[model samples]
Structure formats: C-alpha cells, structure tokens
Target: MHGTSPPESQRNLSRGLILLLATACGAMVANLYYAQTLIDTIGPEIGLSPGVAGAITTLTQLGYGAGLALFVPLGDLFENKRLALLSTAGAILGCLGIAASNGPVSFLAASLITGICATGAQVVLPLASHLAVKERQGRVIGTIMSGLLFGIMLARPVASFLADAISWRAVFLLSAGLMAAIGIALWFVCPTRKPETKLGYGAILGSVWGQLRRHRALRLRAFYQAMLFAAFNLFWTAAPLELLRNFDFTQQQVAWFALAGAGGALAAPLAGSLADRGLMWWTSFGALLMLTLSFIGADVAVAATSVAAFVIAAILIDTGVQLNQITGQKIIFALSSDARARVNAAYMTVMFVVGASGSLIGSATFEHGGWTLSALTGAAIGGIALVIFLLFDRGASDPD
Candidate 1:
C-alpha cells in the first residue's frame, strides 16, 4: 500500500476535516483526564481523602496502560471506525457510571473503564496516519496532536471550572453526551475499511508483548518517555496542593496554571515543523534548556509570592514535555506503519505507568517533605533525562 496508487481524497483530507478529526480525538481522550479537575470536588462529595482519591488517577493510568497493551492492537484487526465507535460507546457508559458513582470503589471502576475506552484517541491517530501521505504526515500528526495536547492541558481548568460551577457529576454527563455525539458522527462519516490482518485476539495481543521484546527502538524510546513523563506527572500532581497549602491560592487560580502550560503545548507544531526541517536536535536542546530554566524559575517563584514565575515555569515545563512526546511519537510511528497502534500501545502503556508512579512518589514525598522536596526530586529526574539524552548513542534523539 505504501507504493501503490494513492486515492485523491486519501492523499490528504481538507484542513477543516483534519482539524475536525483532531478535535474529535481531543474530546474523546479528554474523558480520561477530566477526572483530575473533578477529583477534589468529587472526593469531598463522596467523603474520600485526598490520598485515597488519588487512586482514581492511578487506576485510570493503569487502565490506559492495560488498554494500550491489550486493546489498541485491535485497530489492526478490526475496522478503525468500528473500533472507535465502540470505544466511544464504552466511554459514554463509563462516564455515566462516573457521574453516578457514590463511593470510592465506583469512582475507581468508572475511571478504569474510561481509561480503557480512551484508546479511541490512539486508534484514530494511526488511522489518520494511514490516510495521509508521507511528506505531510509530520504536519498532519502535529495538527492532530495539538488537539490531544489541548484536551489534556485544558482538562484541568475546564473540569475545575465546570465542577466549581455546576457539579462534578455534571462534568462526566457532559462528556458522555459529547462521546455519544462523536460516536454518531463516526458511524456515519468514517470510512469503512477492513482489517489488515486476520489474526485472532490472542495472537494480536501476544504480538504486543512480542514487539516489546523484538523492537529495540520501541523499547528505548518508551523508557525515555517513561522517565520524562514521571517527572511531568510529579510536578502536575503535586503543584496544586503545594499552591493551595503554601500560597493560599484557590482552585480557580490553580486551574489557571494549566492555561500557561497550554501555551507551551502550542509549541508542539513548531517542534514538528522543526523536525521536518531536520533541526530536531536544536529543537530538543532548546526545549530541555527551557525545562532546566523553568526549574530554576520555579525555585525563585516558590521563594517569592509572584505567580508570574510559576506561570513561566509551567510554560517551560510543558513545552519540554510536549516536545519530547511529539518527538517520541514521530520516531515510534515511523518504525512500522502496519503496527502503529501496537507501537502506540507500547509507548503509551510505559509512559502512563511511569506517570502513575511519578504521581504516587510526588504525593508521598509531599506528605513528608513538602513541595520543595517534591520539586527537587522532579528536577533531579528531569536532569537525569537530559543527561541520558546527551549520552545516548543515537546520532539524533530519534534512533530510527
């Protein structure tokens, strides 16, 4: 198919269609993360403590990892539209459960289900990849990823605002409604393509495990992303409480911090564009330098009462993390287009698992040592990642 005659429409979707698909992926994936905003609200509503409530996030991450390992490869074995539609439906059901949950157990279970269903976003990306030509794939993927990053970045503030205004439960219901709408749209609009392989689910899933063993690039990139994500998670998971406890900021104020990070996410397209220009080395160097600077800036911000410093730190941290993720995806997706979903599964599974661990470590450290210690730990990890990258044997960050 790579060298075969190309269809005109499949050559590239119109800009509008690409944006629409990207937005859809963002909306669908947002269901998995909206809980972060609602967690504080919903926890109090259900009488759960902050520590216990965090399990919702942990469970969701674990579920996402599991889905990446087991469910995403189905994209190669089933129709993309069918898989996305079904996943959307499942997400809607999961959101409904979240909206109705009355206890910790129910919330955790609902989150796990939503995490699994959110693989729709992963499936859709590879499908979009297949639709685009090679030359434009970077830009196309970058455009779609912008939506995904926005979904993740905006979820915190949006969820916090919605939870503060209406009810936490209402947020999940709104997401469920959106999921239904997307599912309906896909049912009618998405192309009907058949499976690439006739492998049974057993074989398909086993192949995921097999890929981990066989693909050196996949393993390396996954581990790298995992380390970076751990640091990213540590900061995000701990910062809110640090602000609330030390600076006496409101939830709304903390939510606003996410906006600054989103500004950073906007750099993703620029990073991709740079990669296309064969300047990824410079781009990465700059991004990591920004991250280091942010840590220094954060230290000053903590010492003073200036929110501006925190804002600057957020932008730098997010920029570095977003760039790393885009670069990682670009490399892994290039490995084997046929197994893009599996590759994504492997990458995301490891990334999120480490992210969960980071959150746990951050929270635990914060409980004992406070924000400074947590921040210090995060900075150390980020520095280690930088060292690893510098010492890495690959000529470029991408080891294709």
Candidate 2:
C-alpha cells in the first residue's frame, strides 16, 4: 500500500523473518526489565533510600509509556527498518550510560533512556502484524508475542544470575553489546516498510485521540489490558522482595523462581490460536479468573512458606497475563489496516502508564504490610478488571 513493491505473496513473512522479529522483540524489551531484580544491589551501591530505589522500576516504566506516546507512532511516519534501527542504537547508548553511572541520579537517567529506546519492540510488533496476511495474523502475532513475553519473564532471572556471578554493572554492559549486535542484524535482514499515511507528525499525534474516540472495541480492550498489566507488574515487582524477606532466598534462588515463571510463555501461542477461532471472550474471561485465583494462591503460599505453591502461582499469573495480552492485540490489530501503529501506540501508552503505577503501589504495599497486602491488592485489581470485562465487554464482536 505504501508504494510499488513486492506483491503480497512475495512479501509473506518467511520463517527466518519471523524468528528475527521474535528475537528482536525479546532483545529490545529485555532492556526495560533488567534492573528490576538488581535494585537491591544497586540501591546500596548508590546510596539510594528504599523509597527512591523503588522508583527505579517506576521510572523505567514511565519512560516506556512516554516512548509509546512520542516514538512508537513513528513506525507509521517513517520506514520501519530505519525507525527500529534508530531506536536500537539509542538503547545501546542508554545501556552504556547505565553501565558507566557512578551515582543514583545518573543511573536513573540512563534507565529512563533505556526504557524509552526499548519501544523498538513495540515497533517490531506492528510491523509483523502489517506483514502477515489477514487470516494468519493471529498466529503470526502470537508467535512474535511469545518471544516478547519470554523476554519479559526471563529478564529477571538472567539479570539476577549475571549480577550474582559478576556485578550489576556487567549486566548493563552485556545488554549494550547485545543491543548493538541485534541492531546490526536487523539492518541487514529486516524488510523495509514505508507506511502509506501522508499525515505530518503533528497530525499523526493529533489523530491518536480521534482514533480512540472512534473505536469502542479499542477502548474496551485497552482498558482490560491495562488492568491485566498492572496486576502482572504488581506480582513480579513484589515477588522478589517476598522471597528475600520471608524465605531468605539468595539472588540465585530468585533467578530460579523467575525461570519457572517462563513456563507462561506457552500461553501466548495458545491464546492466539483461540482468538483465531473466535474464542477471545471466553479465553479472556478465563484468563482474568485465573489471574484472581493466582494471587490468592500466592497469598496462601507466602503464609505457609511453600515454595511449590509459590511456583504454581507464578506460572498461573504469567499465563493469565500473556493470554489476555495476545488476545487483546489480535482484536486491536484488526480494527484498521492503515492505522495499526497509531492504534497500538495509544493502547500501549495507556497500559504501560497504569502498569508503572502498579509497580509503585506494589513496592509501597510490600514495604508496609508485607506480601499478603501486595497479593490481595493484585487480586482486587484482577477482580475489578473481570467485572468490567463481563459487564461491558461480553458483547464485543470478533475482528472481521
């Protein structure tokens, strides 16, 4: 649609391209989360107060939200390959800044930049959606999303393990090197996509609000996803603290716990397949219910100090979040062929901002009332999301 180019048949995504996109998504999104588990170590080194240290995760999320608003929409305004490369390059610089930081202020600033640049993952998702045929869109998006979800789930363990083996600074240095490698590979292998939209930058930005107003399904799906993401963030942010305080687990043990949570990545493809079959309503409902139950399970696990129970809860929580996310994305990407990037930007911006607040709330709740309060808060939020979905979203139509 952008210009004279390869026919749709030729442009159909190859296996290699899908793998590349998946890897790119994983690598880029990993940057926003590596610091989450390292906060304990980093805080002492930088003389950060507990309250201020908690802000490390929050600031990264806020930067991601800002990038979703300010940078992700550029996917529609510029060629996809160039846009992705630029973001990745910025991430490399941010990672390097983080590695070299000598104080909390510098570290925090670098984290913000790293989060902002990680929007490259967002760019890759829409580009993948745009490349696939309509009938196979859900499957394609699901596969790529599996990689993104795995990236998110694995970042903590990888960061924690690396931090224990070396130092927190080495984690950032390693990430910077990985970002550079991925950027170079993408430059050579990724397809070029010039979006057909002719709107100026201001016009593109202005259109986001109009797009939201026009699509009731987009609004509903976005709200549901935001709530789910908040719950997701709340659990992961607090779990590490609980393990350390209650179980006396070392960083390596926490890393193993995070590795267990990666089991949830399996749900992404399964949810995508269900969505393709027009089962999003039931799947989403079940996912929300599972999310609620998972938190309850977590509270019980913490009370009894049962590692097995906690592991099960982690799996269920991660699975529920991944299911809802893929299902929601399947619906939103189908709303308009030409406006996928803008619609995605609007949806993700809302989700990340709310999710960031959830991290802050979880940290404070854990500090004051311990894991029980944090778990209950997550359960309550999940219940609220379920109510909203049942009352207003039950009648939502499947994507055409």
Candidate 3:
C-alpha cells in the first residue's frame, strides 16, 4: 500500500478479489474487439458498404484512445472503485446501445461509446497496482493483464461463433448482460480508495504530458512496447487475411488460430516474476529478440505453407509482445505512485496512438506484396526496437 493504507475491503486482496478484478478487466477489454472480427458481417447487415466497413473498427479504437486521454487520468484524482465501477456501468449502456443499433450511423456511434467505456480495463490496472503490496505488484498486475490479453485473443473467435450461431448483435447483447452482473457485484465487493492528487481534472490532464517529458525511463519503456505493439498489430491485422487467402481458412478457423495463439498470455505472470527478480533488461531483450525473429519465422512458415509452423510463429509473436508489455508496465508504474493513473495514461496513449498505425500499414503492405512483404515489415519494426534497446537501455542506469 501507499503511505495511506488501502481500503479495508481490499487490504487482503485474496484470490477471489484478484479473480474478480481480472475478470472485470477481461470483460471490459473484450468490448473493444468484438466489432473487429465481425466487420464483414456487420457492414452488410447495417448497410455499411465494403469500402467504409473499416470505419466500424476504426471509430472504436479512436474512442478508446480518447477515453485513455480523458478518463484514465481521472483515476489519479477520484475514488478508484467508484471510477472503475462507473466506467463499467457506462460500458453496459454502450454495449446495449451497440446491440440495438440498426444502421451504420447508429452502429458507429454506439461503437465509439463502447470504446470509450472500455477504458475501465485501464482503470482496473492501476487500482490493482495500488492494492497489491509493493514486492508482488508486478506479478499481480501481470496476472490481471493476462486476463486482458485473454479477452483480446478470445473476442474475435467468440464473436465469429456467436454470429455464426445467432446474429452479429448477440455479441454486444451478451456483453451488456455480463457487464451488468460484473458491475453490480463489484459495487459490493470493491473498497473505496480515493486518490491523493490535489490537481483538478484540467491540471491532471496537463500533467500527463509533463510526466512523459520528465521521465526518460517512461519514454523508453513506452517506446519499447510501442514498437513491439506496432509489430504485434501488424502481424495480427495481416495474418487473418493471409490465412484466408493462402491457407483457405474459414472465419471459424481464423478464430481458432487466434484462440490458440492466446496461449502466449499465460507467460505474462512469469514475465512479472522476472521483473520482480530484477531481470528487467534481460526479459525485455529476450522478448524483443523473439518478437523480431517470429516475423521471420512466420514468413518461412508461409513459404512452406505449414499451418504448424505458422502456429508456432503465432505463439512466439504473442509471447514476445505480452512479455515486453508486462515489463514495460512494471517499469512505468514504479516511476510514480501518486500519479500512477496519469503516467499510465500517458504511457498507454503513446503506444496505442502509435500502435494504431500498424493496422493501416499492415493492411497496405499485405495488399501490395502479400505476407512476404508484411512479415518482413513487421520484422523490421521489431529489429529497430531491439537495436534501440541493446544500444541505449541494456547497460544504462535506470532513472529514479
């Protein structure tokens, strides 16, 4: 805990409490993704043409970026439990709005709202960090993050299956009901921990940039993850198209592939443990190296037309990304306690804002030269991050 103790309800953070918070993160983050896998079907049903169909996912992502900029920083100023729970309530409304959408305009608007509310996951993270003891914070956060990763990995497949069984609307409808239950349960289960910051909302928002500028470690950590995340996004965005085109994969099969790739999230807790043991540099180096190499392996696997190799590449790619993510988050969170949310918001905003570009780059590269070009491009990105780390971060003294 900080100088002030955590609220009574969260003093212990037993297995059950951790599980609930992790589940909450998973469920909230999942909302940002369901629309992504169902774009083709959703567009056709809602009168959105094929050309503009990408807007459905794009607006959702943009909304999430907005929420991170606007709402996440508030976590540093407000009651943690109330802020997270309120965000959850908003997400439930957003989900229901999305479920009821009948047109392109309505669907897109609802998607944006859902994206904004999905920052509940971001809020949950620093809250968990605040509640956990200092020594074990990394491990606890990594476990919670594993749930977030699992949600991302599972959302596409779940959406595809649910849409296949019922309709595209069921995904959001079901999410709404699940969020409703989670929100209600958390109201009783969560303890109140008010933030110590005295800054008003405007000042808090302004300080986000200040923190980024003040902390060299935060910049490098964010940069490392941003690069890896860009590569991660690049691989995922193009991989599905490649599979469908070259491997003759059905939507359901792509879903399964993604589900299998999710196995990498299991390593997040291990990464956290390594960070706790003070092997941050080694962990990050290995992760970046693996990420860089995985793309090359993916290219080879594609050339051989071997699904097994591709699966291996998928696992390595995901593992590298998650491993680096856990390390990066642990580093930044340690940079400041009082401004954890603001610093977190700043770090994440950088990565996500930058990482969003990878999707566009991936789609374009894949379209032009197919998987060969796209995979190589991803490799180049990873290689850059690796070089930067080896040169600057490897033997350099960590800033306080």
TM-score of each: 0.90, 0.93, 0.96
How well does candidate 1 match the true structure in TM-score terms? 0.90
What does candidate 1's lDDT look like per residue over 168-253, in tens digits?
Answer: 88889999998888778777766554556767888888787677787776776677678777877788878887889988988888
Candidate 1 regions with alpha-carbon error over 4 angstroms: 1-8, 44-52, 102-107, 396-400
Stretches of candidate 2 exceeding 4 Å from the true structure? 1-6, 43-55, 103-106
TM-score of 2: 0.93
In order of TM-score, best first, we have: 3, 2, 1
Each model's lDDT comes to: 0.76, 0.87, 0.88
Model 2 over residues 288-345: C-alpha lDDT tens digits? 9999999999999989989999999999998998888888899998887778889999
Poorest 10 consecutive residues of model 1 by lDDT?
Answer: 1-10
How far off is residue 351 in model 3, in Å?
A: 0.6
Winner on lDDT between 1 and 2 is 2
Give RMSD to native, each candidate: 2.7, 2.2, 1.8
Candidate 3, residue 118: CA error in Å? Answer: 0.5
